[model samples]
Target: MNVNHSNNKITETACKITDEICLPDSDLPRIVIIGGGFAGLALVEKLKHQEVQVVLLDKNNFHQFQPLLYQVATSALEPDSIVFPFRKQINGYKNVFFRLAEVEEIQADSNTIMTNKGSVSYDYLVLATGTTTNFFGMDSVAKNSLGMKDIRDSLNIRHMMLQNLEQAAITCDDDERDALTNFVIVGGGPAGVEMAGALAEFCKYILPKDYPEYPSSIMNIYLIEAIDDLLSTMSDKASSKTLKYLEDLNVKVLLNEAVSNYDGNEVTTKSGKTILAKNLIWTAGVKGQFPKGIDKKHVVKDNRIKTGSFLMVEGSKNIFAIGDIAAVISKKTPKGHPQVAQTAIQQGKWLGNSLLKIIKNESPKPFEYKDKGSLATVGKRKAVADLGKMKFAGYFAWLLWSIVHLMSISGFRNKLMVGFNWAVSYFTYEKSNRLIIRNFKPTSSQTKESGQYES
Candidate 1:
């Protein structure tokens, strides 16, 4: 959508082209934010009542609760329970506008952004664009394996998994069935661990009841990690306990191993180990996603844009960045903050206030991050939490994990839906929303193109 800035001078030529998506000419400064992730969401909330005209742009119109995406993938929760629409999110905010478009590149020199829709110049640009799954230059893995970064990715996984299971249920070929039933998760981080645990739970609880023809033993879950232990970011105690919990649930943990390739049917490891599996999930790592035009000199490893202590892009004055895309280097965080929701939220809020101060001609404060601890759920009633000096596991950690994630979810409707889904599954040991609403084809592997329709 076009944004009209009356305060700034613009050529008549530019105005004519952008009139179709025209935004009201406003005296207040215009702030164009690139993403709708945690950082962008936090920034929008902070600037909701501010004088500036805010334009929030994202390819998807909804903000997804990423942490629980695995639950959606595993059929423990539906997609609607985790997604909040952008328009509904900013309904009461008069200054905010939502646009559905894919950003092509940042024309920093012209103080404008080129999107799929058209060009829109900005007074201030905030790059809260998050990261994309890093396949580490493995083209074969990228093409063949699945990565969970959003709702679409999660739905893809869900479809692939169910389709494979259906094929296994009817297949006469042993190898084909084995390949369909075997699950390989690359990376022992929270995403990988939680996925492995949830899949294992599906095997133990759901398989016997639903797919009674297939023995639960036929299904195998494997968690492979390049590191020596799981949850490497957390304490050693927490990591060890998490490993134990997964093992107790019968998940095979492969440590200090790197995946070399995936050929659609089999995964080859660096150590020459091979596991035949049609479903390979790659949550190994992620790199910041941004368009060309940011100087390569300012771009660091993992494609992250380097930002100063104030969250401003190093070389540009008005262009600022936050969240996973911005590498804000400090004495405490030499490598920049961890790419988590907390880092994004904190940076966004700090930058929001800082921008307000700058707008008012006051000195802005430097960004500071507050560590609120880390939590990851394993299987049913099993979780690990590292809260500074205190570490906990088992029931209490699981409880805390549930509460925090539930409260962090966007809308009250979503919270209630997710809570109700969890309660039903918790007591019944049966997931109610197992219906495949869409017909998924393995070859296409996309919800939009997989011949999806009402089942």
Candidate 2:
């Protein structure tokens, strides 16, 4: 991908060189970005017409809206609602290409990236591989716990919840029925809270309609957070409101609690209490999925890379890390910024502008985080919002959360479909899905590497 900067007023020499550059050779500077999550996707869009030929590599062909993935897992929305095709998104852009491959490792000495398909060489590399759910080095939990990171995880959870309900209704053994009806969520973050709430809502509304033979109150949804409060990143008012909302929806909120051990049928907590829950959903924490070549010393808490103020990795100029994979150094943020989509998007845009400055030989400015706002919805018509200098709760906040997420959805069709579903679900206390297709398997040895395949 050779790019020639031609001045039209120059002589024939410049045009001929430009014409010679029109044909791609081995000389073109290639920019290979990994992971089609928020950071890499945003970077490619911002670098559309640049000189560097951008190769965006990701395991899946679609870019997922992770914030709403829990809803999809809970069956409040469809699979297509939270995913967008990567190549179709960049089809009109002339400079970027998308490759579907699982990155095995990074070979920084030769500027090479190793993938399952083959090896790719890059003049410049940007890693946005993001994070994976951390089970605290517990092999049994990692093996037996269901997560909500991608589309497959969401569908798996959906299948698990629905199937468990059906099993509870049919099983004659009391112990088996009790296990099927009980659900345990092992984190207090937004993912855990939202998932727990959605499961509770399924019990209050959908469960009753689908299983008239069984009592809806028998379906137990438990949320266990290690900290003293839920949504600790948000305002105290928002946290209290969220707790109240979850309680209102009949979700048992267990704060200052942690998981000890969990077999398939029972979960023992750190507090010496045991719950017989067949479905153990883990959202406890996430660790960065950084490629191998970056210095191990740069890995901070949460396995994020230590990035300079300009979003460049320390001791490296052209190499950059952003999104959930990169951690900015700041005394104010000792643990790094929250692993959120907004942070990734902001870092990506800033890095894009900085790249332009690098091309023009100009000084790049440092990045400053903007404290926009935070929000979490518990159940229908209940949510909490924490905007800087302003905080709201209940109906208005829930309405705002709905609109913001709807607008944030990638495609127009997705937004419309989600909006339609929300309207219908609100009017009629019903979920579109009540059929239990299959029982959930915690983890299969043969896992689909990406969301391109369905279980």
Candidate 3:
């Protein structure tokens, strides 16, 4: 092992024989955490400067604020405003180190993990890789439609939308224009509803100013949900209010409808209804994502790893799971805790507070989830909330939603940027400049020559 030092502090190290990732050799027990999501980051925060060495591995170097990804998709916020670099997050934490690598396989027997870059050994392994968009094995819809799982997806949707709108202007055919402007969002969860609302706002405000030739009604927004209610996970009041809010914005809300098929041009529903839409945003579902090597039986519903009370993977010692990727199935939570940010954050914090004790052969209480309520915003000054017995909607709920999300962002600068953008949009109804910087080719068939659709 070759170690480099700066100012009497270990800066880097190379382990040539073991083929291990370069890291300062330490005598302390190393806890390698895969994924820098809410759970992993929370655990990192708790373990920092403590008696353990923490190695954080992630495919991306930045931690994204997922709750506001819809805003980015609809051009209400820029990508940079919602993504914080992982290095910036752990700058002062001496015990914590971040490496940019995608974990490919987990060799739990040897306490080793293989990655694209190199292999690393861990005294304890924590899986917090989180979830990815679930297309339900629909290959057509999966290929044609975009999912809002990350910042890149948000930007892709943005580029697709802007490019389609520009193409809509160029086409003389009315039917082609409708297809180009028609936006279909599948799934009525928080993500889908928020995206629909934001798109509706864009159609209401930005369309008229930007595209003076087309009528405001030219761009049609449709929100499709398999279930009968929007925000089905939320309260009934929230659901109804969301419906009313969306309808008021001229957004066509289709309940009990599921998108069965979608080529590059047409959206076919399960009920045999067809919607001609060039832009399709899928927010239907998500399943846990992690590298292979865990026992098949230990993996449960939604591809989540089955974890015991202490957030430890059932079949393994020294291997734990958290965040959306963990399904802590128990008598109380037969289906595991709700796959939401709060659950992930709480679980992360709990494990962080408890992991040290567990390592010391001390007992820690089982994870217990507290229902913190839900909030979904629909357009400006309109939102819904289910805060334990206090269900509310309209302006106040939206205000609360804004405050909560703003405070929850990772960095101070990001919060300021998002806040400033929101303040400007709130008053002026103006969004960030919709620039189609990249040519978004949704499909190879839809060419720039056809002028039918190319974003």
Candidate 4:
């Protein structure tokens, strides 16, 4: 994606952070986390105990379950299902405090962190800010593509997709309608694969039922990728099965093709094939998103912060990082663990226990990541799961995935609602909440800015 200047109009809407007034004046060790994503939230949950003061900083007041965020974008799940209030999670823990502030910089020498609202001193700092979409320096893709890192991105994509469909309905021009109906998704990871698969289902069944106006075959969804296979992390059999499933659904799975460029109108691939489409969702790659003051060497290949086995930054012992942000060097993972939610949760626990040891005046132990396998759901009753030696696919795998995801939600109410939605969708082949509450107009004043979030 290409880089350009961001409009100053809507950049300051992350959250109006309050002052950092929660820490005690005594010498209790303080832990400051930079993000509220999977890794940082996990750290806070693990560190809720005696002998330490914890201050968690995030751009948003809620911790977003990013794994299911694509569902929110695609409207398979609602917002509340995948999002949990950060303050509510630790409301009863007297030792924990949260501030809705993005860490701007790290004053390592003074052990202080600078934020939009204010600054605070910390005995330990954890940078779990996670990653942002990597446009790979493609100017058009950078400016016009939608990345799926947070809820905002997903909602924006949903609006854009719906808006395109609506626009395709009335537009007199065939080229315009074709472009509106054509959707290009670049990337073949779980996010990309799942999104493409879901969009296909929408095109195949839901759209036909809902919009009886246009021909159901008007939708042309293309899953473009620079890699040869989707779900590179999964086994070859599983990947092969998914590829066949996608083809069976009439999805164009273009492998080993780079999205050379995308202007809001058309996307050109490295193979020189020009695809006309208005909806381009970019999930290609992500780079480490860290604040200033960390050395360049400490930053890994993807801009991730390089940390020791203990997740402590090389130059600073007290300041640490984990999950997507932490580039851990260990015997098994010489670089670091994948930036997944499970890794973040496990790291959060490790950091919590490490703090416990520090309070007891004992040396912190090295962190180890526990692998819990991986899974991906492709449309209705189609899924795959890999648990170490065992691999499963099809409807049964999809059922297992649904159950596991439902139980992993933060609140019981959310779990119930999500479970209900899943059952209803499974039984009826319909999404009840497809109502486009707000019309998405690209570049119009109605289009919410990238930084905008509910206050």
Candidate 5:
């Protein structure tokens, strides 16, 4: 494609060269997407063989199944089983192209985006950049703790956990051993609840077999929530049942408590309580992440870009936003739609189905979100579900959760691997191979206090 440099401030004597990223020359309107999350991929799938050319740019080449990251961290499933490559996803889509690049800024005035690699112009830009972990400006806690937001974060947690358990076995000091084996997960959301449950299962099933030196009780799992209940987004029955399930599994559930600080070895809560722990996982909050250049006036709560009912970004003619980054503000949804996979998928598909019509100056129906319901698993055979008016928990709920997630995975191979792993775990309680292939080093702040165990 030809580079557009008409807006650049160029000097006559300076050498002129095209800084545009090479792409196939096409007369069709080019649609550039900035993420490969559930929303972006859904849009790509919808527009694969359409008249428009779709260019997907992301920092990573793989689209990760986010809901099962806890399993990977707890060694129940391997990482590869949850992440699928973009190239493989778009293999037969002739109109689709994938590029590995981290976008730096967006030049909306010129319809150009600047990435680490080079620049690219789009006829229509879709911002699906999703979100990043939110620490709420806690520098100490942010430096010491790990957040499970991506595949690398999950792997880091896995390695940190395995390495800490090994260190706990090697250490003779009771305090240090306690610090090394202790795990504190902040937030009562789905991610935090699932992670705590998985860790508890690991302590129950895997610890006894792998680390015989220490009793399974030696490893403590604590789940802390700032609010009064777990799974606050669900119903009262679900929240209470989830609390009971975790407690039954010996997970310490601390309600109405918030972490104030962490110095690698100790965690201090806002209520003047302290717990000695080396491992802390933060799943409390997240904020939208996108390349710069959108008008600051249009940015709304949770760092999201304001969009109209048609999913078009405010104050832009051809720019749109989807996924968690886009907030469709209206009288009916004053706080915007729920930032979930269902919402993202629905938005992406809606935009994809309507884009061509929109380009032809034909109006399509406005975007509407349909809630598919919520499901959260506490442990094996224990889960909670809220599907519309019906609320349920126990084995049936867990089964439903499993079926939904298994079918939702991107690839057949991943589904098979995950299904096989789940079946083995169901029968014999055997998990994936826990191997420390590479050394995991925490931030400098975490390493300075305790070099022996850093997670």
Candidate 6:
């Protein structure tokens, strides 16, 4: 395999070859990875000390723990506690290199990728590039609502939520204060359910103490889902218990309703009901995100690239797509695996080993996802879990959820900080990180479009 290198570092691409970016010339095959998400990171770990030269590229310099992003939005945990620097994460790996750049196009024919910085070729190209928020073609909803797919979006939610509460506290008009305090969270998935519970906790514990001038009763938290129940992916018992938990927390649960549009100040439902809420945290859906140059025929529903049983991109030999961007159809999984962290991690690790096997001219194994169960935490001592054979709900499940997430987060410092914060919040029932460090005002277009995660 040939790579365009100048001065043993990346420079620039000229005439479909190398550009400004340069790397050390080596006889080993070069594997270029697009995206630094869970899948990409897993691949990096699996490829450590391998013969091939690896290049990891991402739009952001840091990898944020997406699961805990809701905590940041709710002021339960600080942003730094969940995000770790990518460079530092791979500090001692000499064969691996990380670059900060946005991929603009994929030249499959030439085994080259064009980024904002330049172009580079890969012997084997892996796309672990994950998903972006799906607005469902609702331009108004996309333009007006806030999404929770990234750290920036969580920060924006934090700022906007606190700012609105502050404004509500000083407002004399009851209706205006109501609108400012009314928080509408669309989508009844884990993020929406957990976020609603957290906001309700804020109203019960934080708001009463922090905003003594305003009555906490006016702070309405709504959890809206289009389906018949919350956490539709979970078992019926789990969903029923979850609804009970949310109701017990006094969160208004609206089921069997879809949000049709949002005009910054109002959320209109498909049933023609209008909710006057300044904050609409959309956790509805996400679609695969990739650059141009791939044939449209290879793209499947939700913008995911279709992959063969071996996880190779449908029409390409040396190219593979994994994580949320890949739709690997089989008899067992006709649509695809659920877009979750476990799916991505499993795919990455399997692909990493498979590549080595293929390099040795040995047969690669077909991908199989082992479902390790699912967990969702609602509020203090309220959670649900589906362990396949067994389904449980309540305090024990919540504890399990906490422990799993605490262990899953990156870095000892981050884990320590998050644990300490959770401990403090659990005992005191007050959050100190409510201070709006950065003021965020949503634009007419993207509200939390910072390239780290979707807003």
Q: Each candidate: how many clashes?
A: 1, 1, 1, 5, 0, 16
Q: What is the TM-score of each candidate against the true structure?
A: 0.93, 0.91, 0.95, 0.91, 0.94, 0.95
Scored by CA lDDT, what does every candidate get?
A: 0.85, 0.79, 0.87, 0.79, 0.89, 0.86
Query: What lDDT is obtained when candidate 3 is compared to the true structure?
Result: 0.87
Put down candidate 3 lDDT per residue, 1-455, tens digits, no spaces. Answer: 45654333444565456567887777778899998878888888899878788999988888888899899998999999998899999999888899999888999899999998999999999999888878888888877888888887888899999999999999999889999999999999999999999999999999999999989999999999998898888888999999999999999999999888999789999999999999999888888878889888999988889998889998888999998889998999899999888998888889887888877989999899999899999988999999999999999999999999999999999989999999999999999988988988776332111110000
Clashing pairs in 1: 2-21
For 270-342, candidate 1 gives per-residue lDDT tens digits of 9999999999988899888776778999998888889888888888989998998888887888888888888
RMSD of 3: 4.6
> In candidate 4, what are the lDDT values of residues 1-455, reduced to their tens digit?
22221321111122334565334343467778787776777777787765667788777888777777778887888887878898888987767777777678899999998888788898888887777777777766777778887787888888888888888888999999999999898998889989998889888878987778898888998998798888898988789888887888888999999989888899998899999999999888887777789988778777888888888898886888877777887678876788777888888888888877876889987787788998898888898989899998999888888888887787777888888887888888777577677876555222222321111
Off by over 4 Å in 1: 1-20, 442-455
Task: Please rank every candidate by lDDT, starting with the best.
Answer: 5, 3, 6, 1, 2, 4
Error of 2 at 181 (Å): 0.6
Cα displacement (Å) at residue 236, model 1: 0.7
TM-score (C-alpha, index-matched) for candidate 3: 0.95
Evaluated against the true structure, the overall lDDT of model 6 is 0.86
Please report, as a residue range, the 10-residue window in candidate 2 with the lowest summed lDDT: 446-455
Worst 10 residues of 1 by lDDT: 446-455
RMSD of each: 4.5, 5.0, 4.6, 8.1, 6.0, 3.6
Off by over 4 Å in 2: 1-28, 435-439, 444-455
Q: 32, model 1: CA deviation in Å?
A: 0.6
- Model 2 per-residue lDDT tens digits across residues 1-455: 23543421111222233211221233346777887877877788788777666788887888888888888888888888778898778987666767787777777777777877777777778888898777777767766777777887888888888888877888999889999999999888888888988889888888778889989988898999999999989999989999998998889999998898987888988899899989888888877886578888888887888997888888776788888888887887777777888888887778777777776689988887787899899988998999998999989999999999899877888888889999998999667665456666656541322222110
**For this target, which candidate reaches the highest lDDT against the unseen true structure?**
5
Runs of candidate 3 exceeding 4 Å displacement = 1-18, 443-455
Superpose all Cα atoms of candidate 5 onto the true structure and report the RMSD in Å to 1 decimal. 6.0
